[model samples]
Target: MDISMGDEPRRLTSCWLYWIAVPTGDQAGVMATLGLTQPTPVTFAEAETIIDEDGHGEAEGNPDGLSRVYVSPEVDGWTLVIGWWCDPCDGERDDEVLRRVTELSARYGRAQAYYYGAQGDGSAWLIAERGAVLRRYCATGEAEDDLFTLGEPLPLERARRNELGLSSSWGKAVGNDEGGSEWKSAAFHLAPKIAAALGISPLALTAETRVRGTGVLALTPQGAEAEPVT
Candidate 1:
């Protein structure tokens, strides 16, 4: 049975994707260093096995430290690596883990990583690439926002000025539809647009980037257009 489909085994509180510039053959070495048990190439069967074995493990105490690692079929000379952590919470541990993964992966080549997850009362999404944090969105008390530069400053400025507006209202809107799946879908869908605005190839988005907001400017074939969630 497809575990990703069917009755959800548990509340999926966190998901992450890493675009590593390293070859797919290097995935095992990278993951092993991160303390992930069974750090095998991702496949339907492998995923099922991990889920069956580690599904009940808590994020804060999972012995494996990672649920799974997926190395996407090579595209445009880059290999996309994805990771999933369950029931994640905000803290130094999470930050350190993300930092280590990105930093280590960058040693091999350019790496872009992002994560999306909800805590007890709020949700957030973050993006990083080339060893610098590109964007961060959190729907906590005051809705913190952060963006950094990686050579392209104008686009970052534009995105910041535009401000995706992923405030509490936007979260409520997406949460009401499809049990929060819409938010994840929208966040992934906006990756390409965000990359374009950053003047980078969509693939440079590390196969996926998490974004949140009420409105976003998407680049259509016709041209750039304003897309508002509300």
Candidate 2:
């Protein structure tokens, strides 16, 4: 599935999800734990612009207003947090919320969901339910085809850049065969389950699989370097 040259880095379009449990702490502390020095919170106006362009947070979004979806560039990568800010609401509103949740889920369907919630004692919730971001993006020539011969602009979907938070933009490009990740992220996602099923390391299912807080491993049934898609 890797599409770019092994030596030259290719840029790609990536959207990620960060599952932040409600009322974790102020944004200041959250950024710190992620190793991000500080993050400038987007204003409602700025946030709206990004959502409007992406078809998220539309009037059709949800009744709660408790959910907000926005794109953010960071050192790690391009991200979108389909996050909730209210209590679970006695399950009375859970279904609607869950449905809304499903919408964002579909938008970034293949991303690794990193769950983060506050600890009861209140002193920085590093571990999510557990615990956990990139930058301005660089544009790679490779763009996916969508809708009536139209294509997504590569610049917006580029590599992690200084504006987004990464130290370098060169490695951020997608399409590089060696480091270019397949758009179908499910293989990386299902690695753990597949490994357990095959009784092998997670790497067997995929290469250099890094699922947020989850550590590294080999998952292929054949004891290969990384996991192979089933």
Candidate 3:
């Protein structure tokens, strides 16, 4: 009798994630501007509990200190997940989703931002600011070579790749190290650039940044008030 391992667990596929640099005290305004509803406040410990209990994939938190965690019911096949400390999950890359994320980032004075998503036969990631797509990647095939970049490379884009232990062939083709280093480095280096472009200090992008916000606010259309997600 062959006892086989059960079906492989689904990898936590990232949809789209963003890093917004909200001001220390203006989270409410930013949320409202994004049409998000008032959020439920959860302490770092409580946030961890929620992630362990309800999160679908690998959930990460801002190590510095998670002031609050926000969660909204699934909307249009996607959910709005926000953390005041900086780290948040990716979501669907719909136009509305992108528009909201871009709006929030800009409202918060061009906060550091990133978005990623995978649907059907394609996957893409974006580093954006003030409603502009700064750098992006779209996967064509399973191979790293299948991935394509959009927008011009940043001045330090190549150097960032090197720092992340990635090779120049990254995204062009699968290298000996595979796409692991390249993918990881993309965000690591890109974060600093996002902060810099927004005129925010690099240190602000780290977990040490002490930003705060109302957690898990709801987003509604203009001329309407956002309701808190229960």
Which number leads on lDDT? 3
Over the stretch 69-112, how does candidate 3's per-residue lDDT look in tens digits?
34422212222344322332222323444465567656543433
* Consecutive 10-residue window with the lowest summed lDDT within model 1: 213-222
lDDT, candidate 2, 17-123, per-residue tens:
12322222122332322222213344323443333332222333332223333223221222323233211121253333333333333333322222112111100
**Candidate 3 off by > 4 Å:** 1-24, 57-92, 115-125, 138-149, 163-230
TM-scores for the candidates: 0.40, 0.21, 0.46
Query: What alpha-carbon RMSD in Å does predicted model 2 have with respect to the real structure?
Result: 21.6
Stretches off by above 4 angstroms in model 1 are 1-25, 32-37, 41-68, 71-76, 86-89, 117-136, 139-157, 160-230
Q: Ranking by TM-score, best first?
A: 3, 1, 2
Best candidate according to TM-score: 3
